[model samples]
Target chain A: MSEEPSPGPVVDAAFFRRWLVAAAAVIDREADQLTELDSPIGDADHGANMRRGFTAARGAIEKEPPETPGDVLAQTGRHLISTVGGASGPLYGTLLRKAGKALGDSAQVTPEQLRDALKAGVDGVAQLGGAAPGDKTMLDALVPAVEALSFALDKGAGLIDALAAARIAAQEGALATVPLQARKGRASYLGERSIGHQDPGATSSALLLGVLADTAEQSAAGGTG
Target chain B: MKMLINVPETVVADALRGMAVAHPELTVDVEHRVIVRRDAPVPGKVGLVSGGGSGHEPLHGGFVGQGMLDAACPGEVFTSPVPDQMVRAAAAVDSGAGVLFIVKNYTGDVLNFDMAAELAEDEGIQVAKVLVNDDVAVTDSLYTAGRRGTGGTLFVEKIAGAAAEEGAPLEQVQSIARQVNQSSRSFGVALSAVSTPAKGSPTFDLPAGELELGIGIHGEPGRERRPMMTAGEIAEVTVDAVLEDLRPQRPVLALVNGMGATPLLELYGFAAEAHRVLAQRNVAVARTLVGNYVTSLDMAGASVTLCQVDEELLRLWDAPVATAGLRWGA
Candidate 1:
């Protein structure tokens, strides 16, 4: 947890803003698909819920233009909690706010700090939701992605490459939820019938990490692709 | 989708506006989508709050008034209300007597209420919660996050709201709420499905002669699907399932709830059958209510709830209530 200004690609406030924006774009594109996935086992609003939350989060960050990544994330957390309905709002809001506080007010982020912060976020979400990995929840993807990033960073992986590894891990983790019976959320109401359906929360969690990887790669390459 | 609504996005708000116009004793905070008592923050009285998705009418919103909930926060159809609305309502209605949240046992409602309670406490407002989880159809905890709270929610809200209105302290109100939740059990039967304004399609396609038994209020999959039976048979099955869990050998409050679109005549028929079934099992029904207190937005279905009651619970249940949904003794 040393804050000695470790050298890295600058994942500054601008990077965090881009991450939120990218998340909104991807979730909006997949909103219908998310709802479709939710139709069978849920109230059928996961996609619209995430889309509404991310849109508000994105709009908040863009409007205020916070000076630090931590500030940006904290703002996003507050907006999401207010905008999104259902369990996603509080759980995701806890994730971002806890991570933001863990990072402190550093204008930029180091890979080590990012790992710690994301771990804090994941832990906060677990605590808030009373869910663990293998519960067929967003934690399935989020926890593994954070663990992968931490593991890669410990072995001296580049920040962008670590994020890429996390993204892959998240996608795999999300896919792994397909065979598991839901033990959390609305799908849990279905009991064994919940099997063979991918969790919408896990799917969105994977989307979140994929955007983070894309943001890291684009920013590091000195191009905003 | 057969709906009497405008744009899907405005269904909840539009309904709130209509309620505000129709009920002079309630005020709707359109900005926050909360329905508050016209005279909220009652002097020396514990404020009560409860809410969930919009599809269940005459529930959280219609139950807001003089002797029921002090405020109700409505979400979109079949969705949990956000934490901000709950937090704001508690702050607005807290009169130093504290506030109690009657939350149903759903993942979304639990998390959001927990967050709201924390946020409310950070602002130095006292908040307590009573989570109702009385559906007894599913037995495995490994499969469900927990038992789904259904018809029992209405019982807890009314009984606890009576205690709160009598100037009971926060701890006392919450205790009474929990006690009500523990003594009740419910079972639902769906003869058809509903289309929320937002979804614009039936929740699940029920065949011509099939029905879903032990269904949740959200139209979530039931315990099983079988051919639709006669009204008396359906009533007996649903009522029997609840009585098995309730085990009410003494006096009980029987509620026969219609799932939105069922007719009054049909509800009465179901109610008579439920009463007969309970009597056959030696459970005395002291008070009976048959209406659509908790609904699934025009789904043709019915649910039966039985609450084992002692003298104290009967007193509370008979207390004057003037909510839009239930008005009588007042």
Candidate 2:
């Protein structure tokens, strides 16, 4: 049999746990910034929403550690839906729940599987919000990030490289929203006046991918995300 | 938080708990944070349910008695209630005639209510929905994915609730709600912003002499900001916008609703000016109202909604009704 080099570290329950913890920490630290970003275009609750949602996820994980990687994500998703209010609650909740559900009961997650699960989550968010990429929403960041992650992985990039690509794509996508006029969410009410402001939802989506990438890198070294 | 709340997390539940005791005529389900008429799901009458974030008090809750809403599902402040709450409220209030949901057009409100409607249907309860998007301040806003629902929500709820109370079929009540939405238009102006307890800061800063025009109930920014104007100028701008949108040649019902923190004395003065402006445009104001009926927390502003009312809507508007926030000819 032809010898094939081993791939990067597999995403297991521990990886997801660490990933969620990292995500929560990042959100907690950046809450005010997110809220400030939203004040000009939203209800000024994005940061607070994320803080509450991720805190609930963290608390739930601590109280009842989930069994499978999917279970951990699913629990976190459920908690976000309940504790977080506003559009962010249902939108982000859908993302996690869809991604988690896509993982099924698998004990180990391949890079391809993670990529596909993430796409599923992105699809769910778009469908629920009825938003498109240029709508200046979280999808702006998420769609590009998911596309980049899958593209990089399919081209034989390592898991760490793929996550890095995704994070960069997400960040760039968030920045690109600065010139766009929102067509969805409360920002849409501003219409043309909405231009010149970075979309808060996109900014948070970038934060999400940033943590995911950081977790992947740390996981390679047997460290926390 | 500087506001009068035990804690940020406890705001919704605690206020609802107080409401339960405060109004024996209403049944407050603190477990799910729903308020229902004590005689909810009354036999053969079609039940009406409406709710959104909780900060807009005396709305879905205070209007949860008599000829308003049969049930009100209050979510956390400015956050739409979850599907579970709405589903439970629907199940609890649905009579054989079916239940109707009066939903604001905010994206969160629409999505959550849509989910609950599906859940309610799965449980064998018939349901219909009416989306009120009457705010002409901006076609869409940060909080609203489409047209923001504002003061017109009160008119739709009250009028439709009255129809359902008189044993109107679900379709008729839904139609009434839709008509009210189509015929009504609203605009608001804010002198300041309010702080959510969670944020512990004003949503946005408005320095002296500047005002946010076309504001909504969420205390989000308005369409434009301008120097502070005289009450007469404010009245003229608000009324002119409403009239332009509706272009009503017929008599209309006028409601001047205050954002929270506006004094009644100031509101009445503003209302008088708005009436004068409407008359200047040769618009006949058949009915007029002024109050803090619909609010946006502590945002100091007011919105004006004018509806082209027909005989049917007029009769419904005059119907005897009793609620914590509204009572007339009861």
Candidate 3:
């Protein structure tokens, strides 16, 4: 059996902001790949839409850095909603905004706080998009991330450990969308033809969770070293 | 993967610029991606606004002018425009009477337009919405979301734009638009998939010998794929599908639209076959139009839209309209 790692420290507002910016870059780097996957089922604009949205979010966050982690996420949400111009915009925006609201005015967020925030974010997305788990949307990734985060927190894991768990779950969720027959969005109009393709939204959502894991790990190493 | 474009990022802006250069009467807002009539929101007239993804050129944008849309917000290719753009459009086009939003029934389009209407209402502008869900290929059953909004948008825009231009109240224009939408049916097929400029690849894989039937506008796979058929057989299948969906008992206005790559010659051939099939079924063809009114980038295919016409619809169809993409009556 492999040895388990120790829990890490809490994450602060600046760390969360950095993670948001890094998430944008990750999306930019992987955009062409997302577009390629979308070519088989969707209009090949997922990359362009995500790039525009995250670019705007980065700009907004940099201009007026948030005092709290929640504020940073809220600003990101607003930027995406105004600029992305697609189904992804409003859906992803709702996710960030709702998560941020749950974080409240706290400058630093603990693992349990982050878990609650993710739950709020998932709730917001469901309310705004009316999409459930098997709909082959961002919700697929988001639901898994939330479940993993909650499970880690219950086990007394720290921020870094929980985020790592969330990242793994999110990636698995994204992969699961490949064989799903889309029941929502424009892809659903294709019926059986939509099967055998990965969902672009779920892929992007997984990247977001992965970014969080990377940032938390880096922050933890910097703090303890 | 061939496309006629200068740059990927500037496609919509460049197209709008070309429109302005080509038509001096229509005012184009390069920043907002909205095209408006030089003199819009005619005093005491209900303003009409319609828009969608940018690739369906000569649509919401082309239909903006004196007798059609007062304004149109162009989104990025195959993406819905945000609520802020629609809100700005509503504000720019709102007269005292109110503003009418003619929206396609796609989820993104519906949600964004609904948000914009709410924003406009909050700003003291009265607004009404009419969703166009005219594609009969997909069903609006309990199991599925519903039929997608497709080709018949042009018919609704033309007729309702005319009604609005003639000083109809916002409610009247919206009601008439809904009536037209309810009476129309559209079905499409794709011979080849389209390529996005940024992606530089086809949206789907279609073998040389096969074609996708019952396709939507965004290059989404159709209901079925089968071996390629002759233009005559294709038209028969398309017309038969629409006829079965609408089951109209009256005269109909037929629109045979190309999916961008199909040339006018092929469209004419398809229309000829469509006409023959309609005649055999005893379906009266009141008016016929064949062109690339709505397209899916460079996809090689065509769609058939039929609107059951009454006296009022026929009058609206003949109404004088002027815009950058289409023009009639000097």
Candidate 4:
């Protein structure tokens, strides 16, 4: 795990803010699709709950901006946990909160730090949800995305390229959930009947990672400024 | 659907406001959505906390009084309450005797309560949990999220709450709760689909002349569906389902519960049929509770829960109790 003096921009609080703002936008736009995915096997509120949580998080960040990357994510996680009332609340909240804690009050974080932090977050999610990659949960997408990012960064890829790889891995992982039987959440109650429907949690996870990749690309191009 | 609600978004809040006005003995925190007994943190008594989705009224919130839960956190309809609510409840009700969380086995409730227990324990409050998973309708536990905690929740809450009320330690309270959950079994039959205010329509479509067997409290799809049957036939099927899972050697406490919309007239008739069937099977009845104790919102259905009682359990069951939902002999 060499540091190799990476050439990509080090992410700061502003970069994390842009990523979350864009994430909220994408979640709002795709809320209906997420809810539709949930109808077959879930309680059909994943979309609404995510929309409510992210929108509230976005508002909180804008109302009182944070000073560091860790603060931004930790505050967002707290808001999501309070606002999103379901199994997703704790799972998603733990993902960000644990990752933010791993960020450790750093004002700026390198790609390697972000990667390790997200790995920590995903690990927390697995512990909280007691789910694994094939459980037809968000972990299906998140675990692969973090691994792809870690591998790309370890190979000296630029942050933008590494995040792009992560996004693609996440998307593929979400698609992979369609044929697997759910073992965890509300969907598991359906047993075999849950096989055909893509998990809404994994879909949302992919969308969040995609937004992060896009944000990285935009920052690299000086577009976010 | 034309529900008697101001708007779908405020349904839970509005109901809480109404509950606050109606129940002066309870300290209702409308903004935070945690309901506690007016006199909470009852000295050295073990604190019992239970909650889940809001649609199942009188399940958690209404049962938050003298002989039951010390606090109840109501979430949005068919949604689990977040850990913060549970943490706040534990903080408000813990009186140094430790707290026991009586959780349903739904993935949402389980996850939230697990987090809450961790958070509370981190704050130096000793915590224990007992998960109620008594629905015999769910046959597999290894592959699925285990059984749906349905009507049997009332038995666990009431019986364990009684034990807690009598100055039982947290370990004893939690053990009795687990024992109650182990001895109980439940099965529900839905005559119609449930309509949540958020969905503004039936959560699942159940056509006329059709019924769902083994319905979860949240309207999750059950074991099977069939054409409608009489109360007698429904009772036979429902009772048999519970009996198959619970081969009771002792007399049992029976709960003939209605889903939100069924009237007492029908529930009583169904209860009579259930009693006749139990008698024919040679299982004595120690006591019976027939009403809308645990309900799916506006769903025309009934669930039967039977808890086999030994001498100690029968004594606890006969204890005086007072709650908004269940009160007797106090």
Candidate 5:
């Protein structure tokens, strides 16, 4: 049991806002890829849905800048819930809103705070959608992210390192959904044919977590300034 | 791969603007993406509200007016509207009588509408909800959720809206809507895939000679895919599916709807085949409407809806309706 200090930066309201903006950009950049994946199993609007939802969320955040990290996330959640029109909107919106609500009026979020916030988000999504781990939804990615965050927090890692671990876990979880048969939403209608395709919702969720990881790392290193 | 949309985010808003300009009598809420009767909330009359994603045009929006929906909220393409829009629309349309919400069976729509109803109830407004699950494609077994709500929704909106306009109590209006849902059945097939505006691409890949059967309103994958067949054959299958689910022996109202990309000529041709099939089966045809009432972005497909009509239903059907998406005189 070696005692090694975790290396990372603190996350604040500005970082949370950046995370959302980056998430929108990431969705825009990967919109075609998402559509391509969706063409096989769905109506192919995954990319369009994410792009519209994130763009609207970003615009809302910019229009009314939140004073606290929770505020930023809450506002983003509300925007996505209202503007995006599919299952993803409400699921993601609930995630953000619950997380923001957990964070309350805090300007900065510690690793434990983020872990609790993520748990809140996960609980919120589960309540809203009734989706489980193998349902082939964003929950697949988010569940793993929350788990990884909790693991890092338990190990006494800092916010940045914990977020990085969560990002990796989310990416792996997103990839895992490719081979599993979809059991919820429109894709479930295909039955066995839905297998072997990456879920668009999981992919976008992974992107969001990855961007948050990057922002946390940057802030930790004082590179955001 | 086939569509004509400028920007994904702007499509619904721009369309509402164009609709407002074309039909000045209807009021359009560009910000909230709601269309309402110019003289909304008739005194002492119950208000009716319905909405869904943006791609299904002339649907919720088109049915908003004198004898139909008091207001319709438009969500993003293939998405359910947020609670804000629903609450706002409910508030806008609520008269002294109350408000009736017409929601499809989709999970998102059901959840958001429920939230909005709660919000409205909190504000001391009476609100009731009716869920439409008319598509007979998916089974309502324990394994799967249930059949989706589809083209039959148009009939419910029209008939229920008429009932509401006639000063039916909220309970009666909801009951009428529920009866229409129970008596109706629908099925659809797609010749090609539709492209969403934001994604700027098609939702699914249909080969040049293949078709998808039993598709949902949101371009969800259907029951099966087979080599392309003639319009008569497609209509036969669609009618058979609907009839199988409905087992109708009485006169029924029929709607052969074009799913965005299909032309009027094809719809009429399909309708003719459906008429023959239903006639051969001894099911009386009370009324018929063949057009693009609800649509999936640019998907090339058509859905057949059959609603068993009684005397009361017929009277409601013939009631006056005037709105941006639909129009007819008393």
Candidate 6:
């Protein structure tokens, strides 16, 4: 693959902050949709829960202003754990905190470093929720998104292109959950009835990845100037 | 929506405040959302901690007292409480005999309580967990998240709490809790959909002239929806569902519980039908409790939970108990 002239924006603390801000916005916009999806098989609280968590995470990051990308993620994870109520709180909190810890106080992260950290984070979520890729959980989107990011990065794709690829993979992963039975979380209680309804967690995970890609693309465009 | 609250945000807090005033024997923590027995850590007695979403009133919280739970963590409506709340509750109630977490088997409740047990263990407190997943409405535990813990939770809490109150060790208490869970089976029927405070609308739609069989406490749709049945018909079906799973040779403790919005007038009338069904099956009833013990916040329905109890469990069940939600022989 031909390399782009610019490597794209530096993955710094500010970039992570911007991604979280954008995430909060996206979650707020999609809150109703998420709750609507949850209504059928799960309790209708995923959208409100995510909105509360991401909003708190964004606010906490803005107020404290962590010096490193790792600190931002770790703090955001802590905030999500405390603010968001339900399985999503601990699940998402574990993902971010584990990823942040893997980042190891790094002042800046490369796309490759971010990929490895996210892989660790996704693994943490699987362990915390005891769910696998086909469990109709957030891992459906997250596992594939992280794999896509790693694959694209290994194939020498630029950060923006790789993130865009990850976002698409995540969206596909969310869509795939529509046909599978939920093996974990509230939706699992529905048993066979859970089928045909998209998982709210997977949908939100895709939204988060999409927001990250959008933020990265914007930062890269601004960085070119 | 259109509920009796100043605002949706303050509902849990407001209820906690009301509980504190009404039941001065319990220490209510509004900010941290942990309620403990006023005389907690009753010196060498094992601590029993149970909690879940706020809507299930008189459950984890109201059950807190001398013979039931040592502490209860109340979460937002239909949402599991965080690990911090559970950890704090463990610390406040642990009296060197360790603590047993009586967790309902909801995905959020299981995950949060599991994390809390880990956190509490990290703090040098011995912690054990017994999951109550007695709802037989959902048949496949292997494929799904397992059975949803419904009305049987009360049976576990009361029996296990009695054991703990009698100074049972954490291990024995945990074992008894697990045994209670194993012996119990529940099935719920929803005559109408439930409306949560946050949504201000019905969580699910159960059209008029139809009812949901095997409905979850959180308003999750059950096995199937059928035309509304008479109380006797509903009772027969609900009790039979439990009996088929339990197949109890011994006498059983029967709890014909209301699902929040249901009235005792209807519940007792329903309980009589349940007794008739149990007699028809030749399953003797040891103790019968009929009320709104575990509820799903205004979802006009009732659930039948039958626990096949041995002599020891019967003794524990008859033990003196004093709590805000239940008190007898104390």
Q: Could you list the chain B TM-scores for each candidate?
A: 0.98, 0.97, 0.97, 0.99, 0.97, 0.99
Best by DockQ: 6
Ranking by TM-score: 6, 3, 1, 4, 2, 5
The better candidate by lDDT, 1 or 5, is 1
Runs off by more than 4 Å, candidate 5:
A1-3, A62-64, A223-225, B1-5, B140-145
What is the clash count for each candidate, in the order shown?
Answer: 0, 6, 0, 0, 5, 0
Give the per-residue lDDT digits (tens) of candidate 3, residues B1-330: 556788798898898889889878888888888888888767888989888998888777888898889999999998999888888888888888999998897777877887788889999999999999888888644434578888899898989988988888988999999999999999999999887787878878888999999988888878889999999999999999999988888899999999988999999999999999999988999999999998888889999999998999999888998876667863
Give one digit per residue, the lDDT tens place, for model 4 in B209-257: 9999988888777878899999999999999999999999999999999
Docking class of 6: medium
Show where candidate 6 strays beyond 4 Å: A1-5
Task: Name model 4 segments beyond 4 Å from true.
Answer: A1-10, A154-156, A223-225
- Residue A110's lDDT within candidate 5 is 71
Task: Give the C-alpha interface root-mean-square deviation per candidate.
Answer: 1.2, 2.5, 1.3, 1.4, 2.1, 1.1
lDDT pick, better of 3 and 4: 4
CAPRI verdict on model 2? acceptable
Q: A116-221, model 2: which lDDT tens digit per residue?
A: 9999999999999989999899999999999999898877888888899999999999999999988888778777877899999999999999999988888877
* lDDT at residue A135 of model 4 (Cα atoms): 93
lDDT by residue (tens digit), candidate 6, A37-104: 98888878889889989998998899989999998888899898887879999999999999999999
Candidates 3 and 5, the one with greater lDDT: 3
Off by over 4 Å in 2: A1-6, A61-66, A223-225, B139-144
Top-TM-score candidate index:
6
Model 4 B-chain TM? 0.99
Worst 10 residues of 4 chain A by lDDT: A1-10
